[model samples]
Each structure stands twice: as C-alpha cells, then as structure tokens.
Target: MTTATPHLLPGTEIAIESLPKVSLHDHLDGGLRPQTIIELADAIGLELPATDAAALGAWFAEKSDSGSLVEYLKTFDVTTAVMQTREGLERVAREFVLDLAADGVVWGEIRWAPEQHLTRGLSLDETVEAVQAGLDAGVEEARGAGHRIRVGQLVSAMRHADRGREIAELALRHRDRGVVGFDIAGAEAGFPAGRMRDAFDLLAASFFPATVHAGEADGLESIRGALLDGRALRLGHGVRLLEDITLTEEGGSTIATLGPVAEWVKDRQIALETSPSSNLQTGAIAAWGDAMVDHPLDLFYQLGFRVTVNTDNRLMSATTLSRELALVAEAFAYDLDDLLALQLNAAQAAFLPVEDREALMDTLIDGFEGAL
Candidate 1:
C-alpha cells in the first residue's frame, strides 16, 4: 500500500515526496521491513503465519483490517515476537529512520513500548540504549547518503500493563540520550490514561511531555482523561474527538458547536496525529464512514484544529508519511499550499525546542519554495 508514489498537486508539477515533512506518531515495532521480520523470525525459530516476506506483509495488512482494536493489536504478536532482542530492536530502529528519510521526513518521533522488549532478559535501560544506538547510526547513515533526518524516541507504556510509572522513569532516564517524550498506548477503550495516574503525576512533576493514545478506540471521556490525567500535549489518533462536535447548516453557512473538550483541543491547538489508513483499518472513523474522504481530518483542518498526518503503523497501514499526505491531498483536493501548511503545523507541534522547530520550519519553507 505504501506504493502510493509521490502524488502531484492535482494539476501542478510539485511532487509531495520532494517536500520536507515531520512524523510525530510512527511506531517502532509496527514499521519493520517484511524481509527484516522474516529473517529475524527465522533466526529465532519463531513460527510465522507466512514464511515469505511478501505474504507476511500481506498478513499484517489483512489482520489489521479486522475492524476491532483488539483484533488489530493481535498482529503485533508477530512483530513484537521478532523484536525481543537487542539486535532486533536496534536493526528495526535503524531501518525505521532510513525509511522515514527516504520518505522525506526531516524530523520524526518513534514511539514504542519498552516493556514489550524484555522477553530476552534485556533490561529497560538496555532496551533503550540498543534502540538509541540504532537511531544514532541510522541518522549518520542517512546523512552520509545525502539525507538529513533527525529523530527522537517516544517511550510508551502499555495502558493495560502495570508498568506505567516504571516506563515513565525509564523515559526520564533516557531523556538526555535520545528520548523525547512519554506516551501510553494499548487497548484504549477499556484502559484509559487515568489508570496510569501515578505515571502521569510523575511525568507532570518532571515537566516532561506526553501524547496520549485516545479517541481512536474510545470517545470524549478517554480524551478527557488524556488531557486531565495524562497531561498530554498531543493526541495519538484523536480523530474521534469529532464526536464532541455538532455540525449544522444555517443559511448555507456551516456552524459547529464544540463540546468543552473539543473546544479546549481546538482553542489550544493541541495536535491530532491522524493516521489515515490506520484510522480506516481499525474502524476508528466508522461513525463518519469507511473511506479516506469521510475522515474527519479535513473537517478538523477546516475548523482550525492542528491536525497532523501520520502513519501510525507503516507496515500495518502500508504507508509512509509522504503517502499519507498524498492520500489526504487527494481526498480533500488539497493544493501545495495546503500541504505546506500541514507540514508547518507538524513542525510547530513537534516535541523540539522552539529554535529547532524554527529551523525545521525554515527547511520546509526552502524545500516548498523550490517545489513551487
């Protein structure tokens, strides 16, 4: 599905892949190369649903489209199975960055749960070090190949697991190394961020940033817990926050009434990391309809929300950051300026220093100007 090549601006010569971009919600385990997974699983003697790389990739795509978040998560068993060792973690992280670089991502944050990588006796600290080493090497490799990409890790704790505070501490310990932020993911419907109150409290006291996985599998209440309890600066697939918005037409002018939660999110410009294909695959946008055009992303953009495109799981969604932007551009008839504004929105919302974000924005401007 990532074969969605660089799409032009409808009637223009600008190739979207040639522009600078930012990825804020990519997953480490979920972005593995099929061949990499095949080899890794082979070495570990783990039984795969498909022996061949192509079939394995297809299996992931099919399983993820099962339309239940719980079923969608089962595919991770294959990915995380191959990711239990330091070598697996490092190699996957390395290739993850290279793939993003190829897709024109100048800045990215890769989120993963460290607790899931300890089956091979690697400690939390060791797991982070391994991934960081690979990310650092990937950056150098990309730069050597004439691509400049910078990345940071978003350490996530599984919400249903009891290790939230532990993972938060692990993230804090690696902040100076390569960690950028903390997040909680997994089974969002029954497991809210409030379940991790101690973790959020600890992260809050340290003034660390978090982006909660909310509104994808749940509704406004989960989003509320994300902001009030998790203190999230961003929302991971917060597409369902639209449920809090009521829309109508008066005299041919659209009027949107926002619930208190939606009001705060829109008014504060909290970024929504909307992954198009992933949202559709996991049935997150079932209320709106089951197509990219039906996605609330365009509506959110029109209503002034800081909606940023993402590939939540590149392998599962079979997408790249470029492909996601291209899909949305087609769905909404977006122009080059609209795409540039989306990238700028992401740059501003990145978990970077103001000066660094400004530099990224400048780079985007220069590349976009060249395209124009």
Candidate 2:
C-alpha cells in the first residue's frame, strides 16, 4: 500500500488515522517518502534499486522484513544518500511533519543523528539548523492547511562514534531552537550508554533529557546502562525488558513474576517505545515470535508497565503511527480506551515540561472522548 493509504483495523469503521496521536520514536531519515527519495536521488545523481515509488517502497519493506538488523540498516544507505544535501534534508523533514499531521499526530519528536549527515559537506551544527528550518517550515505549512501540529528534534549521536560530546553540545545549543532532547541512536548492542558517558554527563549538566535505544537489539544489561549511565527519560523499543519477567502457571491462570529490572522499570513508569513492525523486522522480538500477536507489548501493558507504541522507521517498516496502533489493536483486541491509555503514556513520558505534558494529556483525552 502507498504511504498515503490508511490501513484500518478490522471491525472498526473509525479510521485509525483520524484518532489523535503522538509519535515519539520516528526517525527523520527513516520517514522519507519513497517518491521523494526517488526524486532526491535523481537530483543528487544517486542510483536506487527501484525507480518507481511503489516498487521502491516494496523493496524497502522486503529488505527490512528479512529479520536481520544489518540488512535492515542497509536500506538507510539509500534513504540517507538522497538526504545528504540541504534541500533534501529540508524537504524530507518538512514532508515528515506533514505526513505525521496527516496521520493525526498532534505532537512528535523526529530523531536522527546529525553526525551522519555530514558526509555531504554539511557541518553537524549546519545539519541541525537545516532540519530545524525544515521543521519550522513544515509547521507553517500545516497551519496553512488548518492542521495543528508541533514537532521537535531529538538530536541523536551515533553511539559507536566518538562525536557524542559534540553532538550533545549541538543539541544543547539548539535546545531553544526546536531541538527538544538528546539521544544515541546507532548500534545499541555493543555500544552501551556508558560508553558515551562524557556526552551523557554533559547533557545531564545542562539538565537535558535523553532517551537511549536499548532492549531492542540488546537485552537487559544494555537497559541497565541506559538507566544508570545514560539517565534515559525513556527507553527506545525497550521490549526485551519482558525477558526479565517470569510467567508461572498457578492453578489454571498465569501469574507474572517481575525481576528486579522489570520491576524497576514498571515501578518507575519508564515508557517503552515499542515499535511492533520494526521490532519484528529487526528480530528484536525473535525470542518471542515472528507475528505482531506475539509481541511483548501486551504483556508489558497487562503488567502495568508504561507502554507506548511507536514507528521506529516508517520508511523501512512501511508504517505510520496510526498503522502501528491499528496493527497492535488488531493483534491485541484493543478498543479506544486502550489506544487512549497508550497515548496518555506517551504524553506523560514526552520530553515536554510538566505543564505542556499536562496540556498534551488533556488534548488527547478530549480528542479520544469526542471520538468515542
């Protein structure tokens, strides 16, 4: 299906795309329009596997669905190739916001590593500024179209790279200029958050919020590092925390026993930004199973963990926030209240200040209530 096509869940006449939503884990590089990628590649003289937008999109889905993280990441080479230039980055970021607006996202945090964009002669700071410009322009465009939406940048540093400190400083510099928070995005397995202690410390000194990618590619130890060292305000795709929970059959019903890590996360209400399709694609949930129904999101939710749904890579996973929600709703048999609880979890865990977060929660509650 095309990116514009709305995928409704079974038995729900209400289009999922019409429900107000919040997207916290979407990537700027991973949300590029296939048609935009083709044109941008053509503009920059880059070769692509498929010239047609539909075929190119299909190619991305197939590659990502291979259940190999390395192969899945290779798709970004094409998307990032087209996004190297200023105009490409601007256009992509602008369109990312517009697409999220269309998908009923009233607020979103678009995360990408600025260090990755410098291969085309742009400095790290310049890249952040360019993305900010695009975001501002997109917000204006959305307003012109009578869609009220707000987006912020989550400047991500490559965890394996040595430039974490620089990227953290860049985020701090741009904190008031559209950059909302800091993150470390790439290669979560070997690169623990402790490895970027200097960057995390710098951000901490500035009292900045950070969200680390943990429990997706790696397991509980990585999550430990994220909480202890990275001081992460949220866990990006932290689905594997379920591994620490032991389910025991007592009588006929099942009872969940939470390990220390899982208990800590649950007690603290650390939001798990679980991306269903991307989790399946990257084999993050391979230990659980291959299908969306097997995802640990339901377990976490049932256990009273702060569970929030996300689209980690929209282009690669070929999903929107609404689509991801619909998929999970179909698999777990969720109603509007379940969806609202997820949105409320996201709003509470949002990087916004307390007052703004309350406002967002109010907006979500009112929106969902009106729809009901």
| Alpha-carbon RMSD, candidate 1 | 1.2
- Itemize residue pairs with steric clashes in candidate 1: none
Q: Candidate 2 — which residues are off by over 4 angstroms? A: 1-5
lDDT of 1 by residue, 1-372 (tens): 235457566777777778888999999989999999999999999988898888988889888997788899989998999998989998999999898888889999999999999999999999999999999989999999999799999999999999999999999999999999999999999899989999999999998999999999999999999999999899999999999999999999999999999999999999999999999998999998998999999999999999999999999977788888888988999988899889998998999999999999999999999986
**Tens digit per residue, CA lDDT, model 2, 1-372:** 125567675676777787788999999999988999989988888899999999999999999898877678888888888877789899999999998888889999999988888788998888988999999999999889988789999999988889889889999999999999998987787889998999999999999999999999899999999999999889999998988999999999999999998999999998899999999999999998999999999999998999999999998998889889989999999998999999999999999999999999899998888775
Instruction: Single out the weakest 10-residue window by summed lDDT for candidate 2.
Output: 1-10
The list of candidate 1 runs beyond 4 A from truth reads: 1-5
How far residue 340's Cα lies from its native spot in candidate 1, in Å, is: 0.9
